[model samples]
Target: MLHLRVISPVSRTEDVLAMLRVQPGATHIVLTRGGALDPEGDAVQADLARECADEVVDALEAMGLAHTGAITLEPLDTVISDAATRARRLAPGDPDDTVVWEELIGRTREESTLNATFLAFLTIACLLAAIGIVTDSPVTIVGAMVVGPEFGPLAALAVAIVRRQGRLARRSLLALVVGFPIAMAVTAVGALAAQAAGWLSLERIDEIHQVEFIYEVGPFSLVVALLAGSAGMLALVSSKSAALVGVFISVTTVPAAGFAVVAATVGQWHVAFLSACQLGVNMVGIVVAGVLVLVLHPHRRRAFRGTQGARPDRVW
Candidate 1:
């Protein structure tokens, strides 16, 4: 469940309310009315409160009726009701877990740009993974996993499909298409340098049974990516920083790209192909899972306007 606060001019009250009436999972509706101070022509204020289970907030905004109004929806940490019986009536999903769609995509859009920040993050992630592969150190590999910025593109793709935003979809695709190959090339160059300096041996490339996890492209990879994508979307929707961390560690993009570079450095084409396939499979899984989850939890416009720090009243 999610809390919605909508504020609009009195003239649009009926229209907004009518739309809310048909809303799928809205519960606990509240309405408040206020007049303008200047009193020009009855352009009073109307506030409507609702709790919704569905994720149609973004779609609702596109409808254009209340598009111009001032509205806000936020997570309600606690909903306290006096009657235990009434409290039982509340839905199963937690309000804190629910996410507003536009807000979510907005964040993704802001982060998905192929700017200097993206390049910096990507470079760090790839370099760390490359070091891990070369040294065969699990710690560095994990660190690289945590640092990888592939989640942005993956999340962007999910948001694009869920919201049907073609531009977002294309941009995200570009990021992945360009980002992965670039990271691989960089790692390859680094590997070549290391080999020349006698820091890494080409003969050691084929003896990678320990690092098979990075090269294996199987159903399990898909499963992990799906779970990661779900958690990533949940984190984005719920504004949970920890969940985003989980997303960073769960995807195999970094390791695969790094391993591919290692293989290229040593002329191990088979290993490179296998690692690239793993990367592709993980990316597909994450995007598919994210799209499914977001479709289930669309965004809705809110019905209240507050000056500042006005929290929701306790009601379960």
Candidate 2:
């Protein structure tokens, strides 16, 4: 279930209340007139079943509440009320299958930010992968995969394409184009520094055999990427953290980037190229699959239609 809060202008309060009262999936409605100081309106609240969230939010958006006042949706972790149960029963689909687009947009927008923290996590993940490659440790490589933050922008890019949000598409792409190169460059420099310190050498690069799969891109690579991409996007929409982690570990994006950097640092041009190819293949597969998954979503058509003429600057 989702807890919805709407600040409705005085003139629209009646309409908002009437709409909520009639929604079978909306319950525990509360109205506080003149409760909003910033927007200067009435505060209306209700608990809506997950399946009806998109409908309710779309209706509110149509009423111009998104522009004139505010509309916020939050998840309800625990709802013991019989009304909430009845609301869920009245909803059309299973809660786990429902897609709250506003929630998705907000999450992806935040995750796709190309900020210091993003770079830090990416760099750290790459460095860990570099160590994994040198030590030929699959465990360490998996650890790096779990730590990498690349999936956020990739998922955001998919969401942008499906939603037709040009600005979001550009932002997500920028994060990818900039973040990967920077992280790879930093990892390369660190590998070179370690080489200079006698901790790593060209001979060690040639001696590693267990991790060769990181650079050998084949048909299975694309297959795994496609599957992982679909699962990742589905997990994101469904709010499944454990499934998301599985998606993260399933892809070779971070490991390939790290391997490419390390290979390049050791003057293994062909190996670096192969690793880069693996990275590219994984990213493209994930993005394409993600876009398809989101496009096929049941709520996608309504979301696409609802956003027509919406301010491009507004993400949700």
Q: What TM value does model 2 have?
A: 0.97
Q: Which residue pairs in candidate 2 collide?
A: none
Candidate 2 C-alpha lDDT tens digits along 1-316: 8899999999999999999988999999999989999989999999999888988888898898888999999988999999999999988888778888889989999999999999999999999999999998999999999999999999999998888877788889988999999999999899999999987888999899988999999999999999999999999889886899999999999999999999888899999999999999999999999999988887777777767746656543
Q: lDDT per residue, candidate 1, 85-176, as tens digits?
A: 24324433444545554466668887777877777778778888888887777788889998888888889888777555678778788887
Residue 256 in model 1: lDDT: 88
Error of 2 at 149 (Å): 0.3
The TM-scores of all predictions, comma-separated, are: 0.70, 0.97
